[model samples]
Structure formats: structure tokens, C-alpha cells
Target: MSVSFPVSVRRLSAVAVAAASCVGAMALPASAAGPRHDAHRDQVAIGGVHSRSDRSLNGEWVEIRNNGRGDVNLSGWTLSDSQGHTYTFRRFWLDDRSTVRVHTGFGRDSSRDLYQNLRRAVWDERDTATLRDNRGRFIDATSWGYGRNDRSDDNRSHRNDRDDHHRDGGRRH
Candidate 1:
């Protein structure tokens, strides 16, 4: 059901080729580019990811949520470790009310088998992942140092994390 191959330091090209070919070419172009950094703005509080009634984890899984107005195509999206070794996932659409889960595991390289990582791979749990777009742009990055937030923690949150990522708790005039 699951397979893995040890990565060779001498030659990782095979793995790279496998990943590229296996994962199609569909990434966020200008739309996926997102906005510029706000150096002067106050930080907003973000919430954790959501769970679906069909949430079944008989394998490794990554949950994606779209808090943005537009739809993002995750064809060539990649999930990488601190080492940069990545698992290329297929393109999936996350509608405004939709949440998608990617099951990882099985490829040319057995070492690349994502299921092996299990709990550690889930961004919200292990906090050990860097989500990249098809063009290789970092959608999410995490840092245990400086208390930075790139990885999504199961408990930790972002400015706009969940479906209601942007919620106004009502203002008092």
C-alpha cells in the first residue's frame, strides 16, 4: 500500500524527475502571487484549519482551505520538508465552501513515501512543512526560531486561517 526509497545524497535527480513528471503543471500564476508584505500594519489573528465529516486518515493527508476570494488551482503544488525534499500533489480546487485533502504516499522513491511522516507531515501538527505553489512560491512557511509562523499548527492560528478566516466580531461605536 505504501512504498519508500532511501534518498541518495550522490544523486537525487531521479526523485526530482519522478516528482515533476508525476505532478502535473498547474500552479498559481499572477493570481497565486498574493499581496505584498505589510511592514507597518498591525498583525491579525488567524485560526487553525478545519475538519470535514468525511475526515478519514487511513494514510498521510494534507488539508487545504481557501480563505481568499478567488479559487486556487493546486495542480503542481508541493509539500516539502525542511530538507527541501518534496511530495508533489495533484491539482485540486478549493471552492469557497470546499476543503480538499491530499493523500500522500507511493512514488518512484520509497523514501519519498509521505505516509511515513504521518502526524509529522500535517502542517497543523508537526509544524514541519513548507507549502509551495506550482511556480515554487511559498504559500506557507514555518520557523520554530524567533517564534516565526510559516507552518500551521493544529492549535496555532493565522490572520485568516479557516473558512471564516476574516470574521468581524462586530464593532462598538
Candidate 2:
């Protein structure tokens, strides 16, 4: 049996299909659709980290940078380690194009330095540091020490153990 639609009906059906396809193509993932998809997410980044501090606990620190043009308020943002140790920011603002060192030990908070006020070390030689926005949305992460294949102590010496930056579109394995 052959049933042919009128030309107008056929054109309307084709238009509907095209519209549906366009809508589907434009749709973003749930994680990337809301306020969590911050505009400044890429502007802030994790910089160099001196994870190995032999002398003082305060010597161990992670550096964060605001690479954008305007100031960013890091009041509720959190910086966490692979071991689940987290440091929440108080009422603080990071100036544009500035870097701040977040130390592991106690110290007075300043424009350039923030303290976690912990008694012990939080970052390990082979660990990942993750930064999340106030809404708990992932912003950036940095991994150091060893790669997945070089987990064993014997392989650690062979690997470069350099810092690996995992940006928004990627993750630390």
C-alpha cells in the first residue's frame, strides 16, 4: 500500500523533524546547563604547589591564581585534597591577575596568603588537589607525583613526577 502525504504536510513534517534535531543539538548536559556553569570557572586556576615541605608544615602550600580581569570572591569556595582534606574559604576576594598561596599550617589571612590552620600536612606526594566553587561545582584540579601506571614505589623514581593540570573539560585519572 502506497500512501502519499500532500506537499504542505510533507514540508511541515520535515520542518518539525529539523526543528527537533536543532533543539537536541543545542541542548547541554545537566551539569553544564545551570548557574554551576560559571563564566569565571576557567579564569581561576591552580598554579604551582610546593607539596614537599621538609622544614615547616607551613612551608607546604598550594597556589591559586585569578587570571581574569576582575576580582573573584572566594568566600564559600573549597580547596580539597585526594585524601578528602578540605579548606573552605572565608570572606575573601582574590584580586584580578593575582596569585595566592594557601599554606597548610596556621597563619593570619591576608590578600596574598591564606591558611588552612591544620596541624599536619594535607597534600601527599602522589595526590590530586581539586578546587570547587561555592556551589560545589568543580573548577580545576592538579595532580602530582606519579601517574596511574607508576603507582608502585619502584616506578616512582623512573617517572618525572611533574604537575599535571586538569582543566574544565578533563579530569585527573
Candidate 3:
């Protein structure tokens, strides 16, 4: 034989269980949410492109800073663009009050500099760069020239540009 509760009782029990679960989740640390930004999100921010020279591709970069008093291990963090271009960190550490420049083109990796090794550009007149933790949780996101109707910076001279659509091969390259 089996025992069953009234429909109202069963509904009440389900609601109680759900509320308890939510409370428990809230009590846990941010890491319990699976890799979060926390304080590092605010410390690190991206800036605008000073200039985008067609050859060097040096102007296209993302800058991450550690404004806190301790070091930040970016071992598995990732930086990605609106077009899906991503740069993964490998054993990289940002010292206290220090900054790292992630360039779009090929270069040597160091404590202060990293490279995306892409043949083309990753940023454009209007694009967003997102930073994610090791677990792929969003940490921070920065956008420039977006939501603006200005096209004054559109050179319209580079080949394979495709208006920044195909600049990064349309994926993480």
C-alpha cells in the first residue's frame, strides 16, 4: 500500500523545498555559482583604441588590470570578442596594481604581455570584448563605439575586412 497527500499539501511542500534551495544557494560563496568575477571584475577594465594601423595591428588590444593589493592568477581566464575571437590565459599572473596588455597579433608572451596570434584584427569601430573565468562564467565585458551611429573611422580600404565581420575569421582564431 502507498500513502498520498492532498493536492494542496503536495504543492505547499514543493514550494517550501524550492525556497530552501534558493536560500542555500544564496548562503554559499560566489565560487559556488561556478567561477565568478567578484572583485577582479571591477578592477579590470578595457579601454578604447587609440589608433588601428592597418599593418601593425597593435592598436587592437585588451587591457586587464589588477588594482587590488594582491596577485590575480588568470591561469584559465579567457578574453573574447563579439565575433567569437578568444584568447586563453596560461599560467598568467597579474601582480598587484599591475596591468597586462593582450594584443591581437602575433607576439611573444610574457608576464606583462600576451598575444592572440591572429592574422587579422579582432576589434573594429564598434565591438565588445568579454572576459570569462576558468569555468567560462562571465566576469566583465567592455564595448566601444557601439550604439553610436558615427562611421567617421571607417577606413573602407583594407581587404578581407568584410566590415570587421570576417576580420577574425568569424570565430576564435
Candidate 4:
């Protein structure tokens, strides 16, 4: 016995094979169709809290981490407190999945550390840390503890005890 098919059927089979190959390529785990953008690239965060008083500056540091797969060039990035005390980045490159500690006291800048050189504390127990790009574009912010955003304004009187101790007369960056 012999079997015969129309030209249209043959062309359709060829087209189907090509389409399947394309689909297979796309279904790959790591192909060109993979993620074009890093979702965690700009995911900068105020990681650890250092809102306490101590003689050493090490006890008063806020850490910023690059939680992405690619290294982030934070050359001109700025980390500003709610009181407008800003620490600008210079010649700093935060590597992928790494952290750089920003100390409140004077210190040297390194691949894993940066200093704010502030006589007083920078991170307040009731404050927000705003991170911005070089061009002043809003990137990320982390607010902690009781602050202006809290529901209880009456409890704000305690700001003098522990919260407001870090305010440096509303100095500008």
C-alpha cells in the first residue's frame, strides 16, 4: 500500500516543526527570552537598625545592601535622613548581593563601608531613610518605629527621651 499527502499538508508540517522549535527555545530555563531586567537591582534597603546610643560609632550605623544579581554603581547615590542629613555617594560601587555599612561617625570609605561623619546619630528610632539616585530621583525608603506617620500623636512627647536625641538641628545636606 502507498500513501500520499497534499502539498498543503507537507507545508503545514514544516511550519509546525519550525514553530515548535521556536517555542522550545523560549521555554528554556535561561534563554534570550529570559528576564531582561533585574527586579532586585534597584532593591536598596535600610537593612539593619542602629538607633541606639554608644561611645563607639560602630553602634550607630545603617547598612545599605545591593540585593540584586548585578553590581550597582552607587557613585552619586544619596542616603538622606528625615531631618535632611544626606550622605552622598562618591566612587562607590555596591557589588551584587553585597552590603555596605554607612557609619554615623567619621571613618574611611571602602568597598564595604562608608561614613556619614556626623557628630550625632543619623538613624533615628522614629524616622525615615530615603534613598535617591544621582539625579535626585526617588528610589527606595524605609521608615521604622514610631514617627510622624504613626497614629498616636499624643505619644510623640516621648520623642525627647529616645527618638529626638538624634536630631541635629534640622541640618541640610
List where candidate 2 sits over 4 angstroms from the true fold: 1-37, 148-173
The reply for model 3, stretches above 4 Å from the true place, is 1-37, 47-51, 149-173
The global C-alpha lDDT for each of the candidates, from Candidate 1 onward, is 0.41, 0.76, 0.67, 0.66
Span of ten consecutive residues with least summed lDDT in model 3 = 154-163
Candidate 1 TM-score to native: 0.39
Residue 18, candidate 4: alpha-carbon lDDT: 100
Estimated TM-score for each candidate: 0.39, 0.65, 0.61, 0.59
Tens digits of per-residue lDDT, candidate 3, 1-173, equal: 99989999999999999999998888797555434356665555443332255768765677777777878788999987678877899988888888888888888988878888888877866666667768775555555564444444532221222225334444332
> Clashing pairs in model 2?
none
Candidate 4 at residue 86, lDDT?
88
| Order of candidate numbers by TM-score, starting with the best | 2, 3, 4, 1
Q: Which one wins by TM-score: 2 or 3?
A: 2
Question: What's model 3's lDDT at 148?
Answer: 42
Best by lDDT: 2
- lDDT: the better of candidates 1 and 4: 4
| Number of backbone clashes in candidate 4 | 0
Of 2 and 4, the candidate ranking higher by TM-score? 2
- The alpha-carbon deviation from the true structure for residue 120 of candidate 1, after best TM-score superposition, in angstroms, is 11
lDDT of 2 by residue, 1-173 (tens): 99998999999999999999988777756546564346567788787677757788788888889988889888899988877889999999999999999999989989999999988998788877788878876777766676556443311323211233333344322
